[model samples]
Target: MELKKPSDNCFTEVDGFGVAICNYAGDQNHLAILYKNPQKPDDVKLFHVNSYKSDLLTPVESHYLWVDIDWLPPIRKIAITANLKNIIDNNKDTKIRYGFSFNLGCFDPVTGKINNFYDSADGFTCATFVLEVLKSLGVELVDWNSWPVASPEDINFKQYILSQLESYSVKYPDIVTEEFLLGQKNKINDPRFKPQEVIAATKCKEASTYNSIQKPAQLVHEEVLSYSN
Candidate 1:
């Protein structure tokens, strides 16, 4: 496989609550969404996209797919799952589960522009779809399949990525310092190199105003930004 990194455009500032993972190598790319069930996170449902047009996230093309979290106002938090079956020997000898959690508002589905998903406070969550571009950056295909069927707390990808990001920022502060992008790169390319710069990129938190909503808000209020940003 060709060692590559994600395009620079993928790391730009984004403004949507949705995500799209692109696979330029083959046609086996897949998308998955974590549907939040009120405050009960353990009960969240994960649905794999089958019908692009009618599904939560639409596939603009085989290499790109997206979804609007706003479409599901009831969803408190959403996790983007990247199916690395094609890139990695994505199969399980035993049923293992692992994933991380991030604030859902980090992505804006209504606007397709890029945004920073890192906050340096919340730590690493499942920003899978956003980091899919790392394949080209020489990130090993094996790393992508690290997700096991376990709770977010049980997963260690977040801490592993944080250390990577902190180091990359020290050497390359001029460019985008988001961990999901840069961390994955360094972790794969130079795992042994200890970075001098401290990694500050962390996860963001979702707003609490909607915590009491009984039904999906018809129209998301502009003031929602009070907490989202």
Candidate 2:
């Protein structure tokens, strides 16, 4: 059974992959992922992007991000909101890099490696990056956008998503359009995250789709792992 949702359509988990939600504003930002195990539960250290200029808001969820320091047991949701909107966006002339933040002392029980997805794409993979991260982390998926986004005359979210597909690198822009970004600010909102039968059924009929998309990421990750080793 799915766990109780801490917020509207938002579920929380500490052991397996936790659901992730996003909130982006003029200067404030929030990204949350849920997982039960903190690797070193007793002592935790989390590093995040210094570009963050605001105060890392404690997540509404019982558990949240960053390392917890301060003589505590239940890990405090840490954050990187220093330069957030406070300082200017530094590091110009740079394309996208992985992690885009500090290094956390998270570890993978299997490989004994730090549980950091940073070297990937600022801890994001596809435009469905947030969704994929939660899934990859082992959290189950739930439909978050069940409610219709438009009226009969209004534009459908599906089409909006297709139109926002200019950048293959990001995957789904509809997930980030003004509406989604705005909904994040409200205390009460829902992300009807559900499994898309159509997308998952096909074994990639479009041969180049996988090669063009997943290949680059796979190759990049392999290279990083090898270099680190």
Candidate 3:
């Protein structure tokens, strides 16, 4: 995979599916899948699972850290893109919730079914959503079995999420419902797949050889600096 800048004409230069990583404030990041529209080959789009809302598959205008999977053959790329479009079409009306878990939830493209840790609703964090999509495409970005159990920091993050949800529920009572809060609370202890870890995994030549992310925040900072340079 090759990371390209906004000025690199990545949309036209690459003719296949890619991954986009966007860094945000508070050391947060987001992951999404990028692909060209089959009907309009020149139009590139992005698909991602977001928190507090349903999943989105929309066109790209914002610049992100575009990682082009240039290693794939043209035929394979076409097939993957088609499969992704089908997945999107099938789940167009499905309300996919946002939740976290240590386990990378399962996504079955054939049946258009999703199984997450909570098992209450179709849930996935932005990172896991992107990972599952790539997994469906026969691309394993990280070794699922290699991830360690939840740590103290992981637990703390879970608490943070709970608190944030509580605050949001109070502030936006209509949007953040009791059911949504319960679903998120159910998987609070599950191991998390951070966005930086996903970004690091993409750098690995093979998913099996990738072990773990030592410091996610530091890696994210470095990536941002590298992109800026």
Give the higher-lDDT candidate: 1 or 3. 3
TM-score-best of 2 and 3: 3
lDDT per residue for candidate 2 within 85-138, as digits (tens), equals: 111123122222221121222323343233454232222211233334322322
Task: State each model's C-alpha RMSD to the native.
Answer: 20.0, 17.5, 3.4
Tens-place lDDT digits, model 1, residues 1-229: 0111113323111222233333322212333332233343333233232321122322233223233333322222222212222111221121111123222233323332223553322222223322322222122112222223433432243455455545655776543245434434333422110000000001112221222221222111111211123
Which ranges in model 3 have alpha carbons more than 4 Å from their true place?
Answer: 102-106, 111-118, 170-180, 203-205, 208-221, 225-229
The reply for model 1, stretches above 4 Å from the true place, is 1-103, 106-110, 114-155, 176-229
TM-score of each prediction: 0.22, 0.23, 0.79
lDDT of 2: 0.27
Rank ordering of all candidates by lDDT, starting from the highest: 3, 2, 1
Q: Least accurate stretch of 10 residues (summed lDDT) in model 2?
A: 79-88
Q: Residue 195 deviation, candidate 1, in Å?
A: 28
Per-residue accuracy of model 3 over 108-208 as CA lDDT, tens digit each: 75765554433543367788888887887777877787766567887787778778877987998776677777866776656677776786676555773
User: Which candidate ranks first by lDDT, i.e. highest?
Assistant: 3
